[model samples]
Target: MDLIDRYIYAVTRRLPTEQRSDIEKELRGLIEDMLAASADLATKSASGPASDQTNATIRVLKDLGHPALLAARYRGSSQHLIGPEIYFLYTMVMKIVLLATGGGLLIAMIVSLITGAGGNPFTIILETLGSLISGLAAAFGWVTLVFAAIERFSPEKIKLDRDDIFDPLDLPEIPAKKDRIHPSDPIASMIFMLIAMVVASFVPRFVGIFWLDDPASNFIPLFNSAVFMMYLPFILATMAITLTREIGKLVSGRWTLGLALLSLGVEIPSLILTIVMMSNKDLFNDAIFTQIFAWLHQSDPFYFDLPMKILVGRIVIGLGVFGFVVEAVKTFVFWIKRAD
Candidate 1:
């Protein structure tokens, strides 16, 4: 019974979350039918002790074959950018490359801060953030390109991951409830974080106020460039921490006490830094607001004064604090339940 549950979990976990529930039901029905048929066949042929039922169950499972292979069947195709034969190798190589890239960029950033690189601190931080983003992206891209090429071009004779020969007995042990992780979760999070980091690092100037009737050249940036650059280092720090957490999940394929603690450790400081950055009125482009008022053909009003700015900052800080609390609570709950 546990085996059947494990097999179903394995097969459905590989699928999209929206499809998992339907597929799980389908798998259960199929397994039940197979077992019933096997029972009837065994009854007609011969009689035996309880061991016969156990043997029948094993036979049905073996006939169903490996969970990965079954999942592929349900997916309707076996093709992939990187085929099964080298997928494990691809992931391993990717982890190594990403780690190396992150570590190198981090060292460079620290050195720049210490030695007072040619530029001011704000400019130096922006540069480091850009370099970090580009370096990690390049590493990810090159490794993936090479691996996909290998998967496509390699000789037919080359195979791995039990591709040439597979055995149901080789099925992995069923992980504990807390230990099971859907690969897609961490992967999707990483993609989102990467996009956010890129926008923050390279495209802050493009984030601006624009008039629908005017040309793009008339755009006024939302934040003073110099002031924005000063906050880039904070963004960089949070991105690094978030990326590290996701990578840990990816590599371990599960949550651990260390990972949970790492999240809380970074989250508190990140929230503080975010609040400090958001509360700074100097970051807002005074010229941009003046231009906005001029374009509206209205004089500056008391409603758009210091108190208004303080109100907006308070709203942002409130939302940020709520988010931080939710994330912290989730981490603590998961860790506590798993520990129990």
Candidate 2:
């Protein structure tokens, strides 16, 4: 029975998502009917001994052929460039690539605007639109080409929809509800990562306070732009690593011990980078403190002095470490419970 369930899972998971439920029902009924027929035939024959249920099940499965072959039959025919075997993966890849492309281009536009490299707002808007269209087209074309080639030429292992050897025992276990990943989770994670990347890349240029009453000079940046630029690479790298982890989760569509470990691995580098950036005292703009004192029209109190800046940085570092630990513990605990 577990073998049958696994077999159904194996075959159905490879087919188009919309066709899976109906095909699964039909396949289950067919397998059951075949088993019943075999039982009746065995009874009529008065075989030397009762036929083994496992043997009968195996016989029926073998007679039906390999799961991949059966799945192909259910799919009917493939006239499209990408066959149904890998069509779902192809589409999913396309979606993720397009999203990444759009986000990267938007970040580039933000950087340009912040640095005054983009001349006029109207011109920048038009340029961004043109770039977005071209970037999306390129992403679509390249992703489609790769998946099409994989579907047409790659062996079963590479295509990920076929089995080298058809063994019901080797079929993957159906994931428990707690272990399953919802699409929204990965999508949201990716969106958050993109936003973080955009903000990190451009914050050095514009993160500050704007004065409402002062007409001459209205804004004071909070960070030393030069120093912030020096740390940009590490910040972007951290974001990229986390983004890759999210993509892995999306592709896997379930939590595993490996994925949990990978998340912790990614968190380490991210935490280290964040701590480094936060601890760098030279990165903050001293002028911001002066402006704040001027606005309050009072001498700097001890809590608002140079040591206060160091204390604030230490607090941020502590909070970051605590947050990382909480997330890591939660991920591993959930995965362990699900495994049980």
Candidate 3:
């Protein structure tokens, strides 16, 4: 039955991939046996085989309890920092945090390379790697600590009828078959935005280019630091708005009118800021441009000029605006279709 298959999927999904097939086999066998026993008893009593056994399957699943809890039982009673009741949520949060940390570190590395943060390329790379590892460890520890505190101090238990803790009506609606948002989409966006914010605001010096000719003077900062710093607040605000929208999407598990509106709100200001930044003459470092052009001239006998740089900046900004508009339109369309 479809319900049976769904039930099996729900349970097996919580398990490790390697264990899922074996556990599924065992679970299906046990369920079949239980159903057969029930059918046999009914048959003897009624002088015929049981006509409808779907209800029997439902009863079996209910008795087995929540799929997450059932999966935990199969995993055995090991002492855990977080209990089964909130284990799924804990894991999800950990995954998001870890992904964000990794992405942030990657951005930082790119920025460092471009900005020539350190005289030595190897040192910059090593420093970035170290930061990435430490950041991941810190994120993991913080998440575990938070979940552990919840497990220990929260008086509310995740009981089946825990109405006081949560309202049934507040639960997220199940998406229509064709309209479901893939979990990875919001997750990846959140990570990317988190990285962008960290690199842009806190580690702006890392946003430069590197050269191999002169080891000590190989890096060039992309932006005039003073000008970039002045715009940091606006940049950060846009990133924060987008980050919040992504988080909301992750929690709600789908796009909606509210999310689309929120996205538009973020995009409008972001687009404006993009225009302002691109138009400002102080945004680009003249020395860096000169150095890069000098290197280019030496290699190809072609000159890089102001108009070329302006054109490139405009192209980049145009692409960003185009992307924002496309996403906004898609979100609005999805929301409308879902509503209808």
Clashes of each: 0, 0, 4
lDDT tens readout by residue for model 1, 1-340: 7778998998988887898999999889999999998887788766574778778878888999999888888887445788776688578658765765676556556644544422467886788778878778876886677667666655442545226775669655676765666777777676566556655654344566644443322456677788889888788668766765665566556566666777677778778887997789887777766776787886675665564456666888899899988888888887888677
- lDDT by residue for model 2 (74-162), tens: 88755468777667866776676678768877876775565444456677678878978975786577657666665566545353545
Q: TM-score per candidate, in order?
A: 0.49, 0.59, 0.53
- Scored by lDDT, model 3 comes in at 0.73
Off by over 4 Å in 2: 1-163, 214-217, 304-306, 335-340
- Local distance difference test scores for all models: 0.71, 0.75, 0.73
lDDT, model 3, position 53 = 72
lDDT of 1: 0.71
